[model samples]
Target: MTTASTARRPRGRSPLHGGRFGLLAVLPFIAFMLLFAVYPLTQVVRMALSHVEIQNGAFIWDFGTLANFARMFDDALAMSSAVTTAVFIAATVPLTLVLGTLLAVLVDRSALFGPIARNIALWPAVVAPVVVSLIWLLILSPTVGVLNRVLIDVGLPPQGWLGSEAGAMLSIILVDVWHWTPVVFLLVYTALKGIDDQLLEAARVDGATERQIFWRIVLPLLAPALAAAALIRLVMGVKAFDEMYLLTRGGPGDATTLVSLHIRNVFFDRLELGYGAAFSLAVVLFVIVVLLVSVVVRRTVRQGGAAA
Candidate 1:
């Protein structure tokens, strides 16, 4: 039966109207994103493919090829830098999550200082990563650094912070935690705010302790937000470059070199633009995979909870 006419729309407004409105609303954002983000990204990729040959005291792009990737494999410093970057991400991601959660919980509980405390917590995130790195570099400097001076005054031995290979990655991690933890805290705190007070009241009335309510009710509800925060941090952590560069320039022995830094060095320093582009694309693909896996894990957790 041809029921196309009978299945008539009950809409008061045309479908195209809504789409038009949406398009209008999003046009500025799309234009801005394209101009600032996409255009630059495309330029980088293009430059990466272009051949860079040293001539007349400047690197000149001759043509494009996969020569950069081939050279990257043989470049020991590049490979080592990539490894160091991965290690930094692994070390910092978990710490960021934990500290973020703790700060979020504290901020949510404050009756008087919530706004003040939240702003303070968010301060580090607002500070430019490069500036933060520079500040820390001074604070952690081996000679005449305030940190070491304080340690000496406290009768503790002063230790080299970003100056040595052994402590450089840790210093970077600390800087990362200081800067990025607020991002997670804000997300988790927002999720916590959306939770129903009635459910918490019910749990309290049911003789559930505070810890029990948090673990059983609050945590499960906030899992998705936590997962999202972790995914974001994971991506950011893996691609960390600005702070690391300012803090250590990959340091005394390639200690804090991350993938982004390696890519920068390949593209700009070594003039292997094509290889750098490939490496950057690899980072993007890795981030996409991580996000996909995180989404799957969150779904799996929801399904398991439902099953139980």
Candidate 2:
């Protein structure tokens, strides 16, 4: 009787055992964030709130001041940079989305040339932004540029693509669109591939026109992917520094001077570390707000899609 009761006894795990194992599994990631992300952010906050100076190869910090942040209100260049960033985002994001989705649809419908076209479209995304900037810089050069040469040969005058305010802004916007559109295309194309063929077939069987099927059936399914792509592009646009920095260096009377470039100038050119840190924090706050809005938008899209 004793042996039978012992054999039938329930076996249970201590609650702490699983918890410990889970913590152990995530320990490396936590350590990585602490060492790389959190620590640096703390330093940035410290710098932002202090007056920094270097003397005799040593650093000094005079804490307890909001002067750096307060100066932002009077900083005309910084305000202009913000406006330029806004313009850049407004132009690049929509163009990238529309062109990318169109290309994805074209590739999806093209049975014979789909694979080849997909590979070609993905080529620009694989290239580094710095390299893309350099390549475009050469192509947009007023003297000896292939584009200008073609224009000259066709009885058109050469234009200074980066020499004027409008031209520089437009050139950067176009380059950015060219560089990032491929990313959106890949995302939308993958989403397209995941769509059920039977759903489309059923729509056709119901006598729905191709346009109607695309607008009513296909687009609704693709909403989540579109929202995700837009979020990614918006964030990337906000932080975009490489191409603009390398290609134009915020030139043509500050027309292409984005916030990122402005922050860089504060840190290096002006050697205003404290001010730069404060500016960077403001940008971080902006990014966080953008992320929050994106989350809300994505959730709403998902809920709407489920309802449909």
Candidate 3:
């Protein structure tokens, strides 16, 4: 090749050249994350280790150690609140997955009222959780609540829905299911549309019944999407705060107090910034563990299915 042509042509692939544009692109994203997510998280951890005391009409900081963590375990109410939150997540995740998947499968097709059904499912998601909690609070009030009024009309006793410790957590779970089911419905419904029709046709041609086709062909194929929806709902449910905060305020003798609620009270309400940071870290650990377990389980299931 001519000297000019050789010069114009590129040399062998170089790592620096390959990553030059990509590095530039990722720099902005990294900067943004560092500024927003990472910085706040680091600050929380820092504050959790430091003490805040009033000095000369001003707040002063002092370094702390295991004292904050020790306090967390020692406080029975705090420990119970954490346990309650975990139970809330365990209860809600499965319920949301089952209901969301069923709704998605049922309303996925283009029927005369398909749009209407889909719209109704999506409505709850569009409404704010705080607003929904307020509305439910009014409807389920001990005496004058419309829900209790309806039950009374039907000859059943009027019950304290949010007011009672026994039923408060259940009420929160219901509200979560209502507001978030629509999200899963929309996601899974879209996933359903992407499933190949030829598989269904092939199953039918092989003399498989409709039920057989659904169980053997459709469900197996939809497992990944269902897994995705379940993970999304799991994370959201674990971190749920707004509905619980608005509806119950962790009331009725701490029956409905969730981990997030406890964290908020520690950091903001009680002004235990350092201890709150430790609590927040504990929560992060929980989230990480759940996610890792879920990924492993999904992989194991997929491997078993492949082997079978």
What ranges in model 1 sit over 4 Å off? Answer: 1-67, 297-308
Whose TM-score is higher: candidate 1's or candidate 3's?
A: 3
Arranged by lDDT with the best first, the candidates are 2, 3, 1
Q: Which consecutive 10 residues in model 1 have the weakest lDDT in total? A: 1-10
Ranking by TM-score: 2, 3, 1
What TM-score does candidate 2 get on C-alpha atoms? 0.92
Pull out the clashing pairs in model 3: 48-274
Q: Model 1 lDDT vs. the true structure?
A: 0.83
- The ten-residue window of minimal lDDT in model 3 covers 13-22
TM-score quality measure for candidate 3: 0.88
Top-scoring candidate (lDDT): 2
Model 2 CA lDDT for position 258: 98
lDDT minimum window of 10 residues, candidate 2: 9-18
- Comparison by lDDT, 1 against 2, better one: 2
Candidate 2, which segments miss by more than 4 Å at Cα? Answer: 1-17, 300-308
> In model 3, how large is the Cα lDDT of residue 256?
94
Candidate 3 residue spans exceeding 4 A from truth: 1-19, 54-59, 300-308
lDDT (Cα, 0-100) at 163 in candidate 3: 76
